[model samples]
Target: MTAADAASLVPAAAAGRPGTEFRHGLVVGKFYPPHAGHHALIAAAAARCAVVTVVVAPARRESIPLELRLDWLREAHGVTPWVRFVGVYDDHPVDYDDPAVWDLHCAVFRAALGGARVDAVFSSEAYGDELARRFDAVAVCVDPERRTVPVSGTAVRADPAGHWTHLHAAVRAWFVRRVVVVGAESTGTTTMAAALAARLGTVWVPEYGRELTARKLARLRLDRPDATVFDVTWDRDDFVEVVREQQAAEDRAARSSGPLLVCDTDARATAVWEERYLGSASAEVRAAARRPALYLLTDHVGVPFDDDGLRDGRHLRAWMTVRFRAELAGSGVPVVELTGPHERRLAEAVAACEDLLAVGWGLADPLLPVEG
Candidate 1:
C-alpha cells in the first residue's frame, strides 16, 4: 500500500461497491491492557468479519503510556493484519463530541477504502443502533445472550483480583497476568481479589492508600476535624506519594510477562476517592488515572457497609458505583461486573468480551456470508 493508502487506513474490501462489503468489522477501544474478555470478543469478531479495524487512543501521562499499550498489541497480540489499529487525534481542531467526528476522522478511511464498502457495524453497546442508522448499515449486537456484563477500568483498577477475574482474556493479557479489583468496605475486597488473582496467574496490587498510608501517615490520626496543616496535608501527600509508588509498581508489573497486573487502585478511581475524602484532589492526583485496560466493578450483591479503612457506608459505595458507571460509560472503554453467581457472571463477562472484540475488530472473515 502507498503512503496515501496507509494514511487512509481503509478496511479490506470484497469484490463489491455501493452495495457495501458483506464482511469486515470495526472494533474500537483503548485496550489499555487488553484482557481475556477483549480477546474473546475479538476472536468472535474475527470469526464473523474479514477485516477488523482497531482504533486506539494514544496514552496520556496519567494513563498507561501509548508506547507500552501499542507494544502489547503488536508484540503480545501480534500485529493482526485484518485488524487495523488507528489512533484518534484529539489535538486535531475538531470537536470529539460533535456528530461530525466520525465524518471528519473517518475521512482518511473513506478516502482510501471508499470502494471497500462497509455493510455493518458490530457492537454490544446501545450506541450500536445509532451507528447502524448513521452509517446506513446493519448494526449488529453480537452478545448471544443480549446481556450486559458489568466491568469497568475503574473497578478493576481498585481491585483486579477481587472483581476482574472475569475480564476478557484479551484485556488481561495486554496488561499483564493481573486482575484489578474495586469495591466498597468489608467486602474482603482484598482477600477475595487476591484469591482470584492467584487462580488467574496474575500479579496483584494491594490497596496502596490503605497499606502505604497506614504504613506512613495512617497512624497520625489525620481526622477530618483535626484539619491540621501538618496532619491533613501530610496524609494527602502520603497518599499521593503512595499513588506514585503504586503507579511505578503497576507499570513495572505491566512490563513483565506473567499473569495480569491486578492493580489495587487505578489512578482514576483513586483520584475520585481523594476528592471524596480529602475534599478536593490535587492536579497530580487527577492526572494519575488515565491508565488501565478496563475497569471491573463489584456490584451491590455481596458488598456491604464497612468502616475498616478509609471506607464509608453502603451509600458511599452506591454513589461511587454510579459515578464509576457514568464516567466510564462515555469514555469508550469497556466495563465488566462480577455480580450474580460466580460461574454465570464469569461466563457472561467472557461472552460480552467476545461480542466487544467482534464489534471492535474485523479480525477475520465471517464464517458465513451476510444474509440479504
Candidate 2:
C-alpha cells in the first residue's frame, strides 16, 4: 500500500507537454465489470503516456469470465490506436499485500507486453505503487477516494440495477435477462410487460410487429381510401421482417438495459403471429420457439377486444390462445400463465420473473452468445 514520491509522479511530458514523459504506461486490473472509475484511470494514463497497455487479469473463481472482461476492454478502447488491451493469468495470489503476488503479476505483466518497457503504472488503488516499483516505473493514482467516478465494479456487480449507469453497455448486456410476454389479443400483455419493467426498474421493449403493422395499415389506408381492417394482409416476407426487427431491437436493448428487459412481444411471439396469419410458419419462426426465455403467457378470460384494425374477433383470439398454449407446452422453455386483473397479472409475472432469476434465469453469459 506504499506509494512512490508524489512529487516524482508528476504528469509526463509528451509531444507538446513539459513535465515527465512516459514512453510507455501500464494499467492492470481484474476489470471484473469495467466501470467508469476504471475508464478514468485509463484516461489519466493515456494522457501522459505515448502508449498504454491495459492488462485484464481475472481469477479462476470469478463469476464473470476473463474473455468477457477482455471484450469489454477492447470495446471501450478499440478505436484508440495507442491503447493496447491484453489478458493474463497465473497461479499466483490476487492479493497485493504479498511480495510474491507482486512478483507474479510483474512477470505476467511483462509477458503480456512482450518485455516492452513500462515507464508508468496507473491505477486507483494503493497497489499501483508496488506494481510500478516492480517495473521501476512511477505510480500514477487517479481518484484514489473514488470521488470522480463514484462507482466500482464490485458495487455494480453487487447491485446491477442500483448502479446500472456506471456500467458500460457491453458489460450491462452481460446481466440483462430477457423476459418475453406473449398472449392472444386483449390479454393485457403489453400493459403487463411495461408495468413489470417499471416495477423492476428496467427497460421495456414494445411489440415491433404491432408498430410495423400499424405503419403498414396507415400506408394501405392512404393508398385506398376505402381500406378496412379486413384489407390488412401479411405475406411471408412481412413476418420475416418482423422477426428480424424484433430480435434486433431486443439485442440492442439488452446492450444498455438494466438487469431485466421486459418485452411486450418477442421474436417467438412474432413467429406465433405469423403462424396465425399465414397457413404455416417459416423455419426461422419455428426456431425462435426453441430459444431460451422467461415467458408470461396471458390467459384469455374473454376480455373485450378493442379493435385497433388488428383484432380478428373472439373466435380467432380463442383459436390463437389455444395455439399459443400448445406451442408453449412443447417449447421446453419456462412458461407461466398470467390470469386475473391487471394488478394480479403483473404481480404473477413479477413473481415468475423473480423465480426464474432465482434459478439462474436465462443462459449464462448471454452477452457472449457466439462463445457460449
TM-score top scorer: 2
RMSD per candidate (Å) reads 15.6, 6.9
Measured with C-alpha atoms, the lDDT of residue 215 in candidate 1 is 47
Model 2 misplaced regions, further than 4 Å: 1-21, 60-67, 77-81, 89-102, 145-147, 288-293, 330-332, 354-372
Question: Candidate 2 lDDT, tens digit per residue, 1-372?
Answer: 001221123233234343536877889887877888988888787778776778886666667777888788778876655666777664465565667657776887677776667788898987778888888999888999999889976676656666778878988777777788899987888888889999988888888888877787788989897776577888988887887788888879888677778878766677778877887888877665435457889988846777766666557777878888887787778899988888888889889877766654222221211221
CA error at residue 359 for candidate 1, angstroms: 9.9
Question: Any idea how many clashes model 2 has?
Answer: 2
Candidate 1 lDDT for residue 178: 32
lDDT minimum window of 10 residues, candidate 1: 361-370
Distance from true location, Cα of 37 in model 1, Å: 30
Work out the TM-score per prediction. Answer: 0.42, 0.82
Q: Point to the candidate with the largest lDDT.
A: 2
Question: What digit string (tens of lDDT, one per residue) describes model 1 on residues 1-372?
Answer: 332443344433332222434465665455545555455556556556656555554324224554555555555345355554545422222333466655654554444333445566666555566655655667767663434445544445544444446544434544353345565544445654565556555556677767654444444554554432234233467557767887776766665424345566666666666766677667887666654555566665654555544443455776777765665565455677667655555455445433533333112211121233
